[model samples]
Target: GPQGPRHLRPLLDTVLDALHTGTHARGGPLPTGGPDTVTAAVHDAAGDLLPDRGDPDALRTLVHAFAAGAADPAHPLCAAHLHCPPLAVAAAADLAASALNPSLDSWDQAPAASALETLLTRTLARETGHTDGLVTTGGTEANQLALLLARETHGTVRLVHGANAHHSLPRAAWLLGLPDPVVVPAPAGTLDPVALDDALTRLPGPRGSVLVAATAGTTDTGLIDPLPDIAARCTAHGARLHIDAAYGGALLFSDHHRAKLTGLDAAHTITLDLHKLGWQPVPAGLLTVRDAHDLAALHHRTDYLNADDDTEAGLPDLLGRSLRTTRRPDVLKLAVTLKTLGRTGLGALVDQVCAHAREFADLVHDDPRFHLHDRPAISTVLFRPAHAPDPAVAAVRRHLLTTGRAVLGRARADGRLWLKATLLNPATRPDDLRALLTLVHRTHAEGPR
Candidate 1:
């Protein structure tokens, strides 16, 4: 059923060409297209498809248009979020994975993919001082799973997290039917151990079950919670600790900044998103648990997929360890990426981004127009133009986005709106960052129009 390479060449070539045209030919990180316009364009493109006919050219054009209109994270000016430009090799591996379409639910469906995922999970676990883990769709799913495991281990418990924790934490609590989390103040954008201890103490009644969730790199300010101190406190209180390192897990690979995540190994569970700092494509989220037996909460028996007898017979299956029955073998691309770029290479990329963030922070500090919130712990710089109101900041962001000049991040922190720039692209240089800052200044000067 496999198509010969000769037969696939033209189609692959068309796709590659379309990608280059869309990404390179596009003037900026994004196109100046409103929702209505983009929606109409998408509708028109969809109309070209027919059940019985396939037009490669039409498909290529549509893909090119879609890509061209996309927010280009590879652009230096696209310092908005944790989105990182994917590595080319990983992208190619993703294509191969798509072609294979391996489902990881069972050994029969995945085979080598399941083995590779198990291997990768083990390797990642060892790196984080764990025994096993699983790949997830992203941080949200990983965090949710971590909470679920915590809930399974410790009954109806209060979830505790920092103010700058990802929005997913509360949502995960809601989904898990756990009470609203205890929100601790993160004045400096990182959790204060004393504040967290006080929060735990203030809890009503004896603390039967408590899951203290910590952030490794908060999305807004890139602050890492004092993991070692928090771990010690959690140990004292017999509370389970979950570190959401979705954005900052790359620090594990960084030779210079790995110490920032000093207590990562001590966490009962940790969430890592490769898409953010690992330079992989999207949906490269991983949840690593310190104890492999803890995964029993997610284990299940299915005669068709993972029967007890089959396991007893030495048959390997991954269904017992996953929430979804049918899932893509995303680990394939991750494996390819890891092999292509060793740990040191990836670490250097992370170091580069962090260094850039520090430099940007210094620049913001020296500039009279902006107020640097705090020294960046990772790759995010949060600051606001002097005397700029929230509306003005919003307008500047909108003006740049609409004009396709830049796409920056906007967040509300410490009772005021602030602009944020996430330096995830290792290729971005100091000049590029300065240019982005200049754009921000120009947009701010334009006022709220």
Candidate 2:
């Protein structure tokens, strides 16, 4: 067991070297020649997967290919989706987690990790004004769990979510076999309080028969639902509230922007994802519950793992913490990151990224060649080449993708397609934003080559 480092240290060097060489070889945000070319490169490098004899240099070869083809989020030009370049320390901690390979299904398998997770997750939960929380794979799992718990509390509940809500919420409801959800308008990009209140009142059901899903950070445009108004309506209409704050939840760390999420605590459940704003590696998500008693639904016992005698003898039962069995210790990286940065350090990072978005938006506004969407609610800025047809807007994005010049996303808002730049990199500078705009302008001018 202790000899793991001795064997892993050299392999670490090999991996690091491959990553360095690969990023340079890529030379841009993503690999050139687009998906087909990237596919060919991977096939060539992969060779035979199930060879009779194990290939000794497989690690080095594969790591290089993977990194070379990856759309690097750390690059200033790669501003797309909600992907963030993970912090170095968090990634390093993940390496240790992998080497140890502790599964969280039972305490006996991961005693120390189990204890550590309980402490870390509760502390995170309290930040959301909730009594307890569960570590989840990400936002999707957390959202699903929220719906499941609601259904358990009240049989056959209905989901009422804003049109701006994350797609996962309705999907989770449908997966749980709940009634079809009612959709409210988000005409101004944020959920309308009037529409939500009307929907809740019109739906004929007992109190707590409907679950209202609001969003703090939307996937398409990064807009937030009106939490206070939504929560108040839920209270009045006798409905439960679940806020999917997967994107905006990290604002709690930032003193500057936390005010935007003022009524967050009013919800019965809240979803938080650290991988988006906490700079952690993937699979870092948490769901908080206002009532700890709600978690009793998850309690399950299997004699081989979490035995009854083991629990009575002071062994902690880990089965009640999640819906999944055989989970990896994804908490290690999250713990390492939260401990390293604390509130001020993490808040500073949040502030910087938000500032970067505003700066880029201002740049777009000043230039006559581009049309800027409303200012960023979080760190997402939407803009399009001024007077360009929607087809040209789509083509410009593809042109950048094929040439490997930059990586940007597209979102449909206000009945038009706009190029989306989600600035999550704290290392981004003023020059980087300028350069990004310049690339977009030049690409549009090149006429879809």
The model with the greatest TM-score is 2
TM-score of 2: 0.99
Considering only N, C-alpha and C atoms within 3 Å, which residue pairs clash in candidate 2?
none
Assess the local accuracy of residue 449 in candidate 1 as a C-alpha lDDT between 0 and 100: 72
RMSD of each: 1.8, 0.8
lDDT of 1: 0.87
- In model 2, state the lDDT of residue 226: 82
183 Cα displacement, candidate 1 (Å): 1.8
Cα-based lDDT at residue 119, candidate 2: 84
Worst 10-residue lDDT window for candidate 1 reads 199-208
Off by over 4 Å in 1: 1-4, 48-54, 204-208
